[model samples]
Target: NIIQNVLSPFKPLPDVVHRITAFAGSGKTHTLRLLASAYPSLKILYLTFNRDDDPLASEKDNKGFPSNVVRQTTCSIARKETQAMGNFEEPRKKVVRDFLERRLGHSLNYKVVDVVLGTANAWMMSSDPELSEEHVRKGEVCELKPEFRALDFVKLAKALYDAMIDPHCHEISMTHSTYLKKFVLSGAEITCKSGGPFDAILLDEAQDVNMVTLQMLLAQPG
Candidate 1:
């Protein structure tokens, strides 16, 4: 009765956005399941936390959601939305290593490589649209050795962030973060690119969502 009453079909409110919040075991997820069951025809985009494997990535199953309901992690959908598909791990790493070496006037190690890339990832997931060392100072980075913290890694990190999204660097593939970052930078919508906009977006754990993820999910015009 609660589900039926709560989910009663209603006209859209232009200035109102509904947010559901409750403690665990308070029927949050149960409500989502009931909503899907009640509205089998609604084209829903079920956005979830990042997972190692995406059930929707394959053709085997739809993760119990109806045919009209699509499910994907935020990053997976971001990558899909941007049409970035491939394993360019080595190319991207080599680019980072070389970029650092050229900047530091010496060979760079993997630790440095990891920090720079990690920093870039942090910057991408941040709320700010602009690339700046401010992201580095935001306490999002991993624990850095004194040598790193003292060596101006912040500026280098921002530079690397800029290089990843640089339009001229076309041959090398963009990382998922790069795709998501550029998606935010260019005001791209987080639509179901293949099928167009979803009729409704069903975010499972809205409270746990980060700003960048929230921005992407809300970007869908529909």
Candidate 2:
């Protein structure tokens, strides 16, 4: 027993949370490159908020980035997860039509439906559920016209949620944040069976992350 215990390799310590802060033009990207070069074996998730900045645009441009590193925007991550989970039906138009028809017992023109959907998307992205509901109930969604207030924000929120989780649906059209929020709320395990996909996750433009994104990140094993 003593020999076996002595010979057994020690388990590595759990990773701790890391926060890297720097000013504009600082070497944040450089720092990440250095870390990637130093730890070639480590599986890394490098997330950025900039949709235009493809981290892997050019291997020569990102010379130090290891092959094990996976780079993506938070929205892209959410999109991929949604695609992997199931066939989520595209419900942008259906959600608006159903909510208006079922709740208000009224049919709206295509233009009105479009406006309502745009408003719903904005609310879902904002993360201020309570205030959004209150404003909707108070008929405050449109300041220029009270007729637009016929749409109930609460019902609209529910409609969006229902459309996202509908088993028979085939494609998800909701925003990335909405999909991520739904995925997390559905009790899906964020960490893999072997702990997680990566040894460390690097988030760029962290300030742009919404509550749902932050929660998703926090759910991952450090």
Candidate 3:
């Protein structure tokens, strides 16, 4: 059924979003592969949570994407976009150490720095443009009483958010979550090497995507 629907040759594809939804074990990938073959020249963006679905990786035996197709996870896009702004995790840790030790005059141990950075990252995953107390409360991946630890994780998370957001304070690269969030807010589109937008976007496992990430992908400017 899907094969006939999507693989019909010489069919005029309307310039609009074409969504394909079906239950598990369905021939979704098979159909998509057929669609790509039908129109080999179209640039398509294929998104999925499973690494196996990514055609770029050569290690796996899965059906890889065609040369005209680009596969990316939401996290990969975020990190790629802000790579210049936020170098790497280890370097980010060193920057955090300097900030705590010099600018704030508060010496944070390695473990505490990890916890704070982790918490800040969690907050970035949220839909909020700016970090808030409520977001901190929601961002906690761990379940613990408020007064259980010697280190105040929520407060530290806020401090880290402030520093990251304020470019004038110091130079700390932007986090993936922050950069991804900004990408959505800015309403930008992913373009091709020839400076043209993608012909279409294929989002697999759409049910698992968060509201903010989904919004960001769907709201891209043509």
Candidate 4:
């Protein structure tokens, strides 16, 4: 299958990294699934970010799963998987090993961290220990959360029109942010935060996002 082909070289290349960003309707999820199916034993990790309603809980239902494998709705897990690959201090690795081997936390082995936003300079960097350079530089990559930050069909259409009519305008450059503000001004609403560092991100229905929304989306790492 396509998934098998995508993951064929992964066993020998576990350290290999990849990032996939596609336009709307580009079958990105399908590709992710194929890769997951190919590397069934590789402990594939999925992620979703924090939201206002649910501030910080890594475990969530996966009504959206494509197969027996559960879909992730937070970057928390992927970050953990990435951290698992790092060569942490012996004591910390031992702790992690004990937690994993002893079936601590019911083998759920979960941890949650806060979400941060802004430009590289906009971030404070000291909020979450997991988000520090020490972790990310150690191969701790996160995948984007599965939730959509904004979803106003009309506003999305307007953004598309604006992009086509004026490619160099404020909306094009300020995409999700400006468009989101406009959408709100027109009596619509959405949610978003600024900065993130995700491993592989796949945004569905991207054409439906505006500048403000794009700004929020791109702010996260993938």
Candidate 5:
């Protein structure tokens, strides 16, 4: 039963995106370890969603690593890349709240700003600006408090992106999704200075990764 359910599907991987879905305790980490051990020469970037759940840390403590292996939480990688090119900051909750309050030209609850940022981040990660506007007009996007329109959300996102690029005021602290969105949108080159262009990128617990992170992975040259 174990062979059929788990081991059988763990055949040799091809050079493409391979998604493995299974219930917990299905030996996903074991499979990843096997891949890491097998290909010692290939530069592999292993990513996980939670820093506490990093498999590479456990592996290093237990069995050590090959010379070329790199491991990080997805957010860590995004922040590292963003910092490498220029000065960057993650936006604080208060700053975001104040920005939204001013943009809407009225006071807003802190929770409202949180919701707006969450919705706007998800929208930016998944859809282009034009399509997002279309979806907003079509009533596809979620409605927010004070009857904020789609254009309002779009403008807010653009403002955030602008803040990220501002040279004098590098005060925008960004979430992982926002950072990735800005990284790609700015036409910034992803280089090997941070240990990339890896021959194989292994993502354990990949189900937890968001679309923006996935796009960042796909942006890597195969």
Candidate 6:
């Protein structure tokens, strides 16, 4: 029975978004770690609740990152090699807003594309206008649909599943819809391109994502 279940090839549902619901300490993070490790090139973005009082607490707490030595893996090494050109706070916020507005703008010369639609993008989009505008101007325009359509729960779910199944596909832009009190996805589309485009994108804490975030991921072309 154990062998059978282990060997069982579970056929995923059409456009199925693999959602693993696990109890606390149920190895959810562990599973992600395994997947990321197996695919060395995979870029994963993890967004956890503000469990820490200090945002930069982790940086201070894990003096040498010995605690996350196991989970960080090659991902951390790559991060070290490609630390942000400067601080990423401003740029990240801009990306988030541009993602939400559904408008693509050019920063340098490359294009800013959306691989997935998620709340993070929405939250960022709605949070600050100036920052969002800067992101669009700095980044290239993503090839989003002509009309800015809001993504519902169902559509968001489909987008998530689509991103996970593709190898060429990378990047997950999620938005947090808590502060502004928005639930569904809504926004307008803008166009622009970047000087240097991104290579990959990853989203962690997929469960906590909202509709807006999921829509950003769906904005990507399969």
For this target, which candidate reaches the highest lDDT against the unseen true structure? Answer: 1
Instruction: Report the C-alpha lDDT of model 5 over 1-222, residue by residue, as the tens digit.
Output: 553455445443544666777789897766776666666777676677753425466553544545666766766666565563432344677888777777678776655555555555656566253324432332333444445443465566567656654556555654555666656555554445465467777787887876666776677677
lDDT of 6 by residue, 67-95 (tens): 21222221222223222122222224344
Ranking by TM-score: 5, 1, 2, 3, 6, 4
lDDT of each: 0.65, 0.58, 0.61, 0.32, 0.60, 0.33
TM-score of 3: 0.58
Off by over 4 Å in 2: 1-15, 50-54, 58-60, 84-99, 107-123, 126-152, 164-172, 187-195
lDDT (Cα, tens digit) per residue for candidate 1, span 1-222: 865777775322333356777898797766766677676766766777654346345534346666777777777766655666556342367767887888889776677677666666677777677656665543423455445555566678777766655667564456656667667767776566565666777787777677777777666575
lDDT of 2 by residue, 91-180 (tens): 567655665666567765555555555555555555343325542423335543556555565666556556555656544345555676
Which model is ahead, 1 or 2, in terms of lDDT?
1
TM-score winner, 5 or 6: 5
- How well does candidate 2 match the true structure in TM-score terms? 0.62
Name the candidate that leads on TM-score.
5
lDDT of 3 by residue, 24-81 (tens): 9796766665666667778777776432324346435245557887777765665455
Instruction: Report clash pairs, candidate 2.
Output: 88-171, 89-169, 89-170, 89-171, 90-171
Model 4 / residue 88 / CA error / Å: 30
Q: How many residue pairs clash in each candidate?
A: 0, 5, 2, 26, 5, 50
Candidate 6 displacement at residue 41 in angstroms: 2.9
Candidate 4 lDDT, tens digit per residue, 1-222? 665665665432422445556776676656656655554443333433321122223324323333424433332232232222222111232333333334323321222111111211111112221123332211112332323222222332233334322424322222122222333233321222222232233343344443434343344423
Q: What CA RMSD would candidate 4 show? A: 23.4
